[model samples]
Target: MRKIVHIDMDAFYASVEQRDDPSLRGRPVVVAWRGKRSVVCAASYEARRFGVRSAMPAITAERLCPEAVFVPPDFGRYKAVSRQVREIFLRHTDLVEPLSLDEAYLDVTRNKTGLPTATRVAKTIRQQIRDETQLNASAGVAPAKFLAKIASDWKKPNGLFVIQPHEVLDFLAPLSVARIPGVGKVMEAKLARYGIRSVGDLRSWDIFELERRFGRYGLRLHELAHGIDHSEVKPDRPVQSISAEDTFDIDRFRDELGPAIRQLAEKAWQATRKTERLARTVVLKLKTDQFKIYTRSITPGDSINNVDEVSALALLLLQRVELPADTRYRLVGVGLSNFYEPGQLGGQTELFGNEF
Candidate 1:
């Protein structure tokens, strides 16, 4: 069985802030901008007790924890610390796949550190991170990436959990279907309607029945219910997509999205310059005041050339919105996807002229 380790930094951003400022150590700390349009980037353990969470509106966080100390994000500092922790992981294994600045998956089936077990490698890495960065990390060791990820979150915040190959089924049995990776509230609700509440319940269904109900995803659920995940930890995975989004201080109507779309498109375009790949799709995303999300995208015959091209395409997508005329949106986003090497794109003419 392959050995995988998933390491997750504990409240990484808030922890860094707390570590640097001793006065903020015991107090509730929230890393976010101060505005209705802003979202919480991170919350300390103290803040979390008051129902504060990342991605929630900053205003809501403030309401939930009136005493919470809000601090703006310092991405430069966070990235530096992440690099330090990455170096620690490299000492034991080269098969590291970073999920974000604060979490990663490492395949330690054949570690360079000569560790006796994957658990040993994980412990050493966590300790090294704590010693060097003065930050706590939680780790999970398992035979598969998905299980390792789940185990990493079980005890959370400077914790460690292990799932041996033989213990996979028993470990996952009583857990809620929501614990499976990629199974969100929608999927959970769907499964619940079918009387499938726990992993064990899901295990009772055959792959044929699942596939008939959930299509290809049903087949995936069958495997996960049986504690099977064959995906590997790939280092330096290529960028699949890049996007920028902004929540408005007040809800806006469809016609008012032109400026926001252009601005976000410009932001996404600037970010794309950092990568060598070309983007073939322009996407426009909107979230209604009721929290429903919609996306419209177009892939021209040729790769998008410049910010203006993306901005124009994104703005054009505004007409594609089929929401009620009185509908208002709380958020808007612009994105570029379908990344390809320059060699993969041919010299084809633009397929759709901007007929707007």
Candidate 2:
């Protein structure tokens, strides 16, 4: 069995604030701007008790916890601390897949520190993070990523849980179907209609029936319900593309479209720098309220190397599409694709076009 460990920092941003400031430890703390439209980036466990949560509007968070302290996000500081956590993970295994700024999955079947058990490796990594950064982390050890991810959340805030290979099914059976990755509100509601409230209920369904409803995701859900995920821990997951999309609650105006597209393009461009890859194509995607999907793409003859070029190309692509004044869109997305290493661009001089 491949030993996998998932580590997640508890209320990452809010916890960091609490740890750095002694007085914030036991208080309800929400990390976000105190603006009507600003969303809570993170909420401390104390704030959670009052129904504050990440992504909730600051106004809603305030209404829920009137006395909660609000702090703006400090991304630079968070990234620095995240790097330190990654260093600790590297000491255990090079097969680390970072899920976000504060969470990662590590395959520790063979570790750099000669750890014999995944649980021990998790403990050591957590200890190192606490000692070096005074940050609390939760870890889960299992035979696969799915179970390990679930185990990590079993106990929150400086906790560790393990799901052995033989105990996987039992550990998963009673959990809600919503616990499964990608089974969001819509899927959960659909499953509930079928009386499939938990993994155990899902386990009773025939594989064919599930496949009929959810396509390939159905088959994957079946395996997950049985606590079987065979996905390998790939250490070198390449950055194929960087994209950002937002679905609006209501259709937006044409005048508002320009600003939204620019915002998404900027976000995508910023995300591209997270990986050491160069983008060769810019793409624009839109989904109308009627669920019609439209995509427009441009491959610059010259390598567009910076955010300014990306934004300009995105705007140009947007202008190229002829949308009716009445055509309201539910979603808009911007993306960059055809990523290559810096050295790989040397011979591709012809790829750059006048668009650049």
lDDT by residue (tens digit), candidate 2, 1-356: 78988999989888888888999989999988786545677899999999998767678999999999998877667767777888788777878887666788889888888767888888898899899989899999898898888889889878999888888888888999999989988799999999999999999999999999989999999999988888887664666777988888789855567767766776676565445457899999988888889999999887767667877898888777798977888889989998777777621111000000
- The lDDT leader among the candidates is 1
Q: Give the number of colliding residue pairs in candidate 1.
A: 0
Model 1 Cα lDDT, one tens digit per residue, 1-356: 78999999999889999999999999999998787555677899999999999767788999999999999877668777877887788888878887667888899998897878988888898889889999999999899899999989889889999998878899999999999988987799999999999999999998999999999999899999999999988885666889989989899999898877876776687556444568999999999999999999999999999878998999888889888989999999999999887788622111000000
Candidate 1 stretches greater than 4 Å from native:
242-282, 286-356
Candidate 2 clashing pairs? 301-351, 301-352, 301-353, 302-352, 302-353
**Count of backbone collisions in candidate 2:** 5
| Deviation from native of the Cα of residue 251 in model 1, angstroms | 13
Question: How does each model score on lDDT?
Answer: 0.85, 0.81
Residue 350, candidate 1: Cα error in Å is 35
